[model samples]
Target: MTLVAFRYWLAGMSLALATLVTPLSTAQAISPLGGPRFAAVLMDADTNEILYAEQATAIRHPASITKVMTLYIVFDALDAGRLRLDDRVVMTPRAVSQRPSKLGIGVGQSLSVEEAISVVAVKSANDVAVALAEKVGGSEENFARLMTAKARQLGMRQTVFANASGLPDPAHFTSAQDIAILSAAMIRHHPDRYRCFSEQSYSYGRLRLANHNKLLGVVPGLDGIKTGFTNDSGFTLTASAIRGGRRLIAVVLGSPSGWQRDRDITTLLNTGFTALDIRRNGGIEDMPALLSSAGFTLNRSLRPVPQLATLDVEEGDGE
Candidate 1:
């Protein structure tokens, strides 16, 4: 689709979205040619320089991207010795009640804290997220408060947390800039456990759940961070890639579809790498050539939506 038409299409899909949230910060950079209206940021992880930013501080619904904070808090607990990789997380009835994009563990059943981390990181499992929150904060509500407090400490000034699982709460919001802050903080503070974000899949008994972040395989140096979506938040991703000793974190919020989000991220990463003069393992190319050759627009290389039947939990409202 032409860029103009694509913007209108995106706007049409999100009419109700406008009233649900507002951008506290405005983006100055024009959306790159053939891109949709969204908020984004690209940063040099080591230098903490802004490589490119568009509505980076704009308030937007985080959807499941809120799990990045959920994991951050979990990682902090791990660092403090308050939680352990082998600690058991007993599934609460409240946890069992979360919506899909979840691990279907039953109430009273338990998995190790490390296993819970892998489940949420790889699968974006809502149930597991709530369980971790309960373990850490005694309740999801309390954990969300801690998430907001920690966000403040990390300088994610615009972020707020309504729940641990990142379900659709109007009050639950974050900016691309805040997400980048969270991503960078995780990399700096807990490098050891950050690999959970790059895991492609997690197995529970007979079922297997795949990571929603599609760029992990398609992008040369891309490692991970997270992916999130709800009808409310559109599709959002915070991704990091390393090449020639430099790392870049790119955040894209409010894409119309999963493929578009991936395409935009790939484009942003390509642009950021170019700006840094960092070459990919196979050499480098311009944005259009990089994207077209990588097949973002043409290929419908979406992360496969896991079949709900694969999860064993009883479902209720969730993201």
Candidate 2:
């Protein structure tokens, strides 16, 4: 079924099952890990409701999660007919000079846009990110400007992009809520291309680059998205999952470790799904109360959602 039709059908099913949903016990609720650097936000993809949030609006480094926005620009180019998957993306010296966690393609070598996207999405290839940036925006610096512009256009007021690969720059930062917005926009505007994020691995020549996102096959209904890390950002992840025919986007940033980041995201998604079910069934009045019952510490001062302007873990200097 078409996505829209499926969403409509899912809404109906949710409402029908609402009356049958039992009270949520403590056993059913998952509490996320807490940390000084931790920030997160969970959103219902269909309704854009903020289901759970903790330090969600605080500024934090994005790490390799920057690639999500990079990919978004590429997807936009594809939609505008300026880019094609089969088109060649040459590896420039600058792209090759990028840090590790790269595809290792030679400076002069080339790969199709499709392959480039896979390596960036699945492998978190820094080199390929720069190549794609240069391809689309002439240089990484210029591309970053475009990234920031797109962020503003999409109502992401707190984000700023300093590079295409999300390498550490004092200027490159975003909040968890902003990341959730970006994730939803990608799924909303480019469902087809977004599937690339779900790929577990990508074959480029003899190398089989595995996705850095460890939760892919392990978490039920969890699908495409991204993972990132750096000394400054800690371990971060933006995950999307569909349960009970509803999709939710969860973003966790600045965890102390990769495993913890994954764990927090899993808990957030689970808690979010349960809360959504309860809300649909008329068992809850407000999200704060539900989150409290689920054992989450809420930062009661949430910033108001702005009107629309439009729209991983790892080591080294890259991930």
Give the best candidate by lDDT: 2
- Cα-lDDT of candidate 1: 0.74
Clashes by residue pair, model 1: 27-55, 104-313
lDDT of 2 by residue, 1-319 (tens): 9853553355344333322332222111112222226688989999888887787777777788899999999999898898999999999999998877788879789999988999999999999999999998777876777777677668785677778887766666778899999999999988988999999988888999899898899888998799887666667899999989999998987666676668778877878888778878988656666656765555522332212111032344445
TM-score of each: 0.77, 0.81
lDDT of each: 0.74, 0.77
Q: RMSD to native for every prediction?
A: 11.3, 13.1
- Model 2 pairs whose backbones collide: 154-311, 227-312, 228-312, 228-313, 229-312
- Candidate 1 lDDT tens digits, 1-319: 9853553344333422433444433221112232224677878899888766767776777778888889998998888888898999999999988888778878999999989998889888898899999998877877777777677678876777879887776666777899998999998898989999888877877888888887888898898989877655567789999987889999887676777778888887877777567344455535445445555342221222221221232232232
Query: What's the distance in Å from true for residue 64, model 2?
Result: 0.9
Give the top-scoring candidate (TM-score): 2
- Identify the runs in model 2 with alpha carbons over 4 angstroms from their true place: 1-36, 285-318
